[model samples]
Target: MDATPPGWPEAVRPPGAPDWERTAVAWLFDLVPPDYRAHEVLRRYPVLLARFARDHVAAGLEAARSGWRTVRVELADHLPADAMAAAMTAYEREGARLAAAARGVAVVSAALRGERWVPRL
Candidate 1:
């Protein structure tokens, strides 16, 4: 009976479930830098925290993509073929992870902003 969209983070309960917002806040905090937890405003404002998480995830995704694009060219002479292959693999994995995180953050942020999801036919 879970109504959450695909890519919804397992750590965040479905919106409107008991203590969901608290769970969401905790999940969102995990996406941002550790230093972000020190900001009282972010702790007090879940919506803002969600925005921060979204931005952080987006930046990470972009960074991974950029690295993937340039790593082979930038390090071709500096590293062996095995190391280059590993760097490409790392970037690919990170891009996928951040893409999922971005999706989860988007839905969580929408929920925090009072937007509810209705089932579609």
Candidate 2:
């Protein structure tokens, strides 16, 4: 019953992957009760988000990194049935893109640092 969608193996970390929790915001997610987590990130982490956004903007950027600010919108419940489905499609598309990009960047960086293997053809 693994509900993971297809094309997600790129993002799934292998078992026993080195822990990075101390260096990332994923820990902020576990603070929310699962049933109540859906709309809680912005409400709970506004300070952190604001600081990050400010830092991103001060770097002479007009928008937050990766479009963070507009990511938390909540559409009214009155939308047509297809609206939620469309949203899900968009979310999935972005999620896949981000995951793939992260994997690509990490591998490239590791290779540059002599950590990832580079095969000769």
Q: Rate the local accuracy (lDDT) of all candidates.
A: 0.92, 0.39
TM-score of each: 0.96, 0.36
lDDT of 2 by residue, 53-98 (tens): 2343234222223333344454546556587666656666655554
Q: How far out, in Å, is residue 114 in model 1?
A: 1.0
Prediction 2 global C-alpha lDDT:
0.39
Q: Can you write out model 1's per-residue Cα lDDT over 1-121, one digit (the tens) per residue?
A: 5598777899999998999999999999989899999999999999999988888999999999999999888889999999998999999999999999999999898888888887798
Best prediction by TM-score: 1
Off by over 4 Å in 2: 1-73, 76-78, 116-121
